[model samples]
Target: MAPALNVELAAEPRSAARSRRATTEWLASVCGYASSCDIGQDIVLAVNEAVSNGIEHAYADEDGVVTVCGRIEHTAPERRPDGAGPCGAFEVCIEVSDNGRWRPPAADPGHRGRGLMMAEAAVDHLALDKGESGTVVTLRRRLGCPVSAS
Candidate 1:
């Protein structure tokens, strides 16, 4: 059994912080406390990082909503389960979409450089797609939270 939670946030730059906090709250409600907190923290952090990049590079100054979706799907307990797609592995798919520029720009200058890298390291799979609407970065992860799904 998997629970699907989808959230849409404002296009403002500071919204990334709110997104992380909102995600933390959701994880707190569902994931509980203890080590799961750490796992959830990482997930939220990674998602925020990716979303921030999208806000900066993908949409630029365009006004659009950033959508982040988390889905839990039933898969073999040994595999990824808490993820977005059907691959299982306790994974998570975080998508940041904007109605602005779709193509990914070259990595930006220093300091703001590690967001994408951090996002990639936190998840198992990373996807960046551009279309007429905008660019979306989906990060997938199957790590942390050892809770059983029997």
Candidate 2:
């Protein structure tokens, strides 16, 4: 794998599905050693949640950009099987930025406040930044599964 994986997306709420697909492909390719459908689903959900939140809370009806980055851990070659052992866990990071008036609305007892929470639940870590232009959310998840059958 490369040193880092990066993907940038325009502010298109309807295009969230595209972003989701890209993330799925990336995860499958980068972690294509272990087979775990559950883990794959987790990564997909996290990506969907983050992208959805970015569209709803950050961009709303305006325009902006969202960035996704991934970095794989490096392991010793001898420990690796056939010099192709595990690629190690991946730090799947996502950053969403928009140029619209937005705030991560209070986590209320409602549906709108769920995306972030679900996203957080799906990943290992999540960070939020709210400002005048919009909101930026950073999410990370370690993928331990492969794309084969899962």
Q: What lDDT tens digits, residue by residue, belong to model 1 across residues 26-143?
A: 5555444533455576788788886786666665566778787776543454534655443324555567566667554457655647787787777677887878877777766664
Tens digits of per-residue lDDT, candidate 2, 41-148, equal: 786787778777666667556667766665554333232345666743345566655555666377575655677778889878888787875666777765544322
lDDT of 1: 0.66
Q: Write down the lDDT of every candidate, Cα atoms only.
A: 0.66, 0.64
Count of steric clashes across candidates, in order:
11, 1
Model 1 quality (TM-score): 0.74
Question: Could you tell me which 10 consecutive residues in candidate 2 have the lowest summed lDDT?
Answer: 72-81
Using lDDT as the measure, which candidate wins? 1
lDDT of model 2 at position 81: 48
